[model samples]
Target chain A: MKRIALLLWLSLVLPLAAASDAHREYDAMETYEPHVRGDQSLSGSYKHWAHPGKLDWRLAGNPEENWKLNWKFMDPPFNASVHGGHFALDRGEQLFRELNAKARFARCLGAGKAGLKGLRARYPQYRADLKRIAGLEEVIEYCAAREGRVLQNGSYDNSAVSLYVASQSNGMPMRVDVGKGVMRDAFERGRKLFHTRAGKLHLACSSCHTHKVGLQLRGSVITTPYGDAVHYPVYRTRYFLQSLHLRFAECNLDTRTQPLVPGSRAYTDLEVFMTALSNGYPVTVPSERD
Target chain B: MRSISILAGLAVALVLPVWAQGLPRDAAVNAAAPNKTLEPRVVTNSGRLEWLPHAHNLTPWPTLSHEDRRPAPKPRKARLAGPLDGDAGRGRDIAVRPDKGYCIVCHQIPGEEWPGTVGLDLRGFKQRQYADAAVYQQIFDARVNNAQTVMPPFGTNNILSEQEIRDLVVFLQSLE
Candidate 1:
């Protein structure tokens, strides 16, 4: 009888202890910086630029120097402009207002644009009514469905609107509530997904992002996962206007794992896990990557 | 009555595919079907294309998912007792190729450009004087020596064959 009681006590206490350890690791990753070759001044700036001809001239000089120059030029732009128009952000805002007009998101979410402000920072939270964790994309899709519209996850319209909504919370620190309820479960699942090795290569996300940060994989440098969640719905040179789930799918393909459906429970949980890691970092959306 | 209903369901299930085959091939196959397999379409320079069915039917490893807490494969003993007779040239090729050993991704091998600095530099690896079998075992599974190693179990996981690991061993031994 005593052993049974002791076993029950251990089961209840062990998970709580493990949760605290996970939180400690999360705190460490939030501030951890991996060393990489680049000018520190050009880290997060968008205004720093060189003329196209001069940039080309420098790129032609040395092959090794070009790799460094690429990183210097690849910093996320503050306002990503493509073909003389902020197409993604503009389209996103238009869709957000349109969806709002049809669904009256202002009624439930908040009134006016002020309600939209800092909204992105609190997402991937447990929605008690829905009885599950909901990311911004999932919430948007749910609202869209009520208006007799189908907004597929990772679709262009979905990404664009998500980008706009996320842009509203720009400069606000991300604070995903992983303290209680289903959110804690989701957070734990996300952490496991991030560290678990899968697919043909048997490489976990941490194998490159954490263990081999700043190291070269083929031609590209492996980057740290810190502050990465800030820039979602980002435009990349190879893939224009991509959502975070799309990026996850791309990573899954790279590791030869079958990609999960976007906005699925697992992916949303992963978003929550990753976004929580960037707790103090300001949200930066619609950024460009190379 | 239940048996009759079950027989009717089975008959319909068997006939459905046959009926669908009368339609266009593309229309017959539901794109959203979960188990639908796709063929690799290879387009030639002349714009000619062919669908090579099952050409890319590579199955993912039967490894544990993120939720599973199962430990990875244990280290195995070395297959051979002595130095393997492998082509050093082929071993070098395997080490440098991105799809194969990709040793250059972490190890800074001699005369390799843009080698990563994650692992120790292997310029004077030959001077270490380790036996060829030891090197072979290390490449097969580094977890034997270091339980917490980030290195993948190439042999155990079937990422590399015995011969490929042997080639890698020869390549590493030749590094100077």
Candidate 2:
């Protein structure tokens, strides 16, 4: 009788204990781990992401000067031979720059979102149902991409332009003021766009990033959307100088959608919305990726 | 001894359904699908006009069309018939494996909370009019017809090996 009881306990109670222990581990992870990104708390700011001994973001050079700061974000972005052969060069220069090296810098969009009150007061009629319905045209013409002088080379003068602007906020937290009101509307648009599957693949941003955050494809991690925003101006060895907007355009291509011009109002809106979603994350600019 | 046997049997009965559903077959899947070869569109005499001014690995991947080019032919290499005798258990592992095909990302699978609605719902797949060959072909490479197909060329691009494709074929086809 004691042996039977022991068998029953072994079969049921022990397994139950293990399962509960696994749950406890998950719960502990939930409680202790500071969110790297995608924490979904709209009221939170990126300042809370300060984990004392994680990444040291105390550098003072642009991405062009200090590629060392983004050492962690580097994940070998290109097939050296393939990219080099295509560019008519020797197949070894991994740091080869494809976009314009003289690309300029602009203020971060999250800052613009934080200071949106002035714009709201300037154009009050753009408001609707407790939220600002600021159209893309108005946003584009008014701000000029956060005090950016439209460098001529047709919108996206190449990857260089994006590197310049995004490098300005390399060490800061990704802060977009989408707590409510106008920024919220933009965030909603980005959210909708993210969920809306498109093109030949019928893929939405949420399809990979949200639903399958840790899933892998082609030997690379399908990163979740939240923590992904701050690592802009990636020195994608495959594409050379890849900006966050250019990456969006590449994704548009991957999905078979007509890509919006980089630095366009559309991309800025999308960036603002994504940045707002990722409000409480650190900026890790000039990162490398495949 | 009798009580222990009964307890063990009960435990087996409880766990068997999940095990069966998750790993449908440990045995091999049949190679019933015929080879569907797609002709490459890059006829080289045109001064490589299809090539982008700069090769950023962006253009020339598939269809460069800006608009919806789905259901179009992919620019990847041709796929021969995949292997027979695939292990469905391994197939499930490959399907769920991260940083790879990520089939679960877009394709709704069992045991996932946020199964995507982008691709064909994997549920009720057995009821669909898919033949064994058709099932294998779609999963192996959906871009054969759709040049801009978002479904990766697992077979052609070598993302999933031929054996893995066969395994996925068996597992997916068995989804009733």
Candidate 3:
């Protein structure tokens, strides 16, 4: 009789404790609103109709104030909340900042300068609407669904969202600057990761995309990394809207290396480096691939 | 006898749930959610492979090969250890398999085209600083010998089995 009573009590108490703990881990002040059309690539609206003004906005101009957004990864608060320790957090922070920085830059470009030429050249067609639509929420959905597709040709099978994003800069040329500054360290690190063999295959980003640009991988023709970032989002017929950092994370996984979070610093740094590498190429999004 | 049989049955039932609970779970990878459509096929230089597995969070790779099923003691240094058994043909297949060991991605091997420049060309590996054990160590997990190595830990991470590593060693050795 005592044993049965104990088991009942234990199961009930343990589940309650676990549930509360999960509740606390999530951002208390934040909640996401899913897509209305019921698209899996978009976050799903739970229960009934949408809640107004509930978008969990990322890159609120800067990251210092938004550390708890779940997307502002590796900050001291986030590390402490999760007890992520030092080495792991340190590496994660680098990647997070890099990705966040690029997202910030892309947003900046999209808001007003998307279609301009030279350094500030963003696709003129893109405006605040593009950034408004390209939410990290969708990225979370994409990651959850595991919808990445790499064509037999080395280029990614991106989505219309990305293609729409990239096309905004169609008339401009890529002019990403790796000017001498604190950011140079990030650029260098990104370059190092590009060449370094990683992941299960022990292959670097340069293996297929750089050194073997024209080489065939299965049925896919390897494309150059140059000017690839300009297409901020690509509409891969198979994969759908692929953000720049998402593409980088997908590549990291392919090389068999554990990918940092999508908006992590490592990917951001990689983007900065890659964008700079393709400095002179024309920007196009939703680039057609086989 | 009837009471004892009842007790035995109760014990077996109790143990089964515990065993079922202990089964491996993929909580680490939440990307395994049911998809609306089946994933598409992706053919890469590494033969027929899928990108969906890569997208999903880290999961232990499916173990292949029954050869050399033994594992060396963990964290042991084998930089100078020479391998005992290896198959050159198998090694070559692994090297070229885009989904498997892409050794050709970095080094230039004899008779193999499409070599990369990131690592030393293995075309003349026989005449250099590479000892047989050194080659084995490097292939297994070059990090053991060099902490900063960009090379993957093939053996340590179970990316390649013990037999597969030995086969790679032999193929690399015969490159000259």
Candidate 4:
């Protein structure tokens, strides 16, 4: 009798415990909404469906007020009592602003009043520190590490985000400080790599895109690699979200070139190269494109 | 012997309800729900594979691979080329190649062969005033700007990791 009771009790209690653990984990993950929110790329409904608004909208930088959004009274599908409560929309926006202000490479030297024309003239140059090669994102990482007082979480780190925040300086000359040896090496390596061709397609990057661009081969136009940096974080029609590395990686795959992972050193180097190519172009994130 | 047999029979009857209770409520209500869908085909990049096993018929993928007698294909070398250098040739190749990274599928690159006009053109990209790195950063991940871009976050997409993107930058830079 005792053994039967114990076995039955164990089975029931074990299942209950498992259920609660699952629920708890879900709750914890929910707290990291900011990171995941970028993934949903929700349609228009996101503005209304997120957490409710709390009236505690403090003045900018009050410090004392608990950050939250202020939505008007509207009933949600879930709990009625919590209808008009707050979501952290304002808080998320605020953090983005704070991070943006301290971005690296905000005003790269040589960015004269003339804008991007002169800057685009010199590109695919080599860098020194990243002896292999470098690009805009790499420089951004270095700048963030050196000036923004932050860590370079690899290529797509938040520091990259901050660098993008500084892309407002479109139409300025590329002030790439090629003074450092490491910078020079990177610039040169970047140039050589740009010309090299390796893929089943047997075509170099310049073969089809630059020389034959605008001419119809299959059913597409070849595009010139200029003024691409000005519009980023662009809302594309096909993809679920704005993905810069995705485009870079996709291009490699298309070229039959070796594909590298998103956060790898090679990708970072390419990023720097492309940035230099579009030197003086102004940046426009949150851009919408078809 | 007779008494023991009677006791065994009683125990068998008593266990039926208990065993049934252990099943999920939905399962108990519809034990034949899985039978409704027959031969459902799941479409992936490799084409139509197989339908997911029923919940009641939980089976591992590796084991299923063996049972189906379909051997997986060998990995291709192009998928492993790594990353591109920042050059016009590389960027041009990227615009054309399909297996690595093709930007022309939905994007329009002016002066390229049959450039796609779905997305904005990349002609005169250098005209943007920001540093090359800033442009690279945008190419690295445009999600930081607008989240809803048909352009997959390639780095985030796992198709091409960060290093590959760096190589792509090299190819793109050479265009100028």
Cα-based lDDT at residue A234, candidate 2: 53
Prediction 3 TM-score vs. true:
0.45
**In TM-score terms, which candidate is top?**
1
TM-score of each: 0.69, 0.41, 0.45, 0.34
- Which parts of model 4 have CA positions greater than 4 angstroms off? A1-93, A97-164, A167-174, A177-180, A240-244, A288-290, B1-176
Tell me, per candidate, how large a share of the native contacts it keeps.
0.15, 0.01, 0.04, 0.03
Candidate 4 per-residue C-alpha lDDT over A1-290 given as tens digits, one digit per residue, 9 for 90 to 100 = 54555555555555445533421000001110111122123112223323333222342123221111111111111213321011111221333355446432333412346532343223323545554444443444454555544423222233224233333332334444433665544444444444433333323444444334344334634444443433433334443223344455446545433343333444444444445444443333334333
* Model 3 chain B lDDT-worst window of ten: B62-71
Candidates 1 onward: DockQ, in order: 0.12, 0.03, 0.09, 0.03
Clash count, one per candidate: 0, 19, 39, 145
List candidate 2 segments past 4 Å from native.
A1-37, A40-72, A75-168, A264-266, B1-176
TM-score for chain B of each model, two decimals: 0.62, 0.52, 0.58, 0.46
lDDT of 2 by residue, A47-111 (tens): 32333134334421233222222234242121122331123112111111221123211112112
List the per-model TM-score of the A chain.
0.72, 0.51, 0.45, 0.45
Best by lDDT: 1
Candidates arranged by DockQ, highest first: 1, 3, 2, 4
Query: Could you give candidate 1's per-residue lDDT for residues B89-141 as a string of tens digits?
Result: 88888888877888888888778888877776788899999988778877887
- 2 versus 4: better lDDT goes to: 2
Docking class of 4: incorrect
lDDT of 1: 0.60
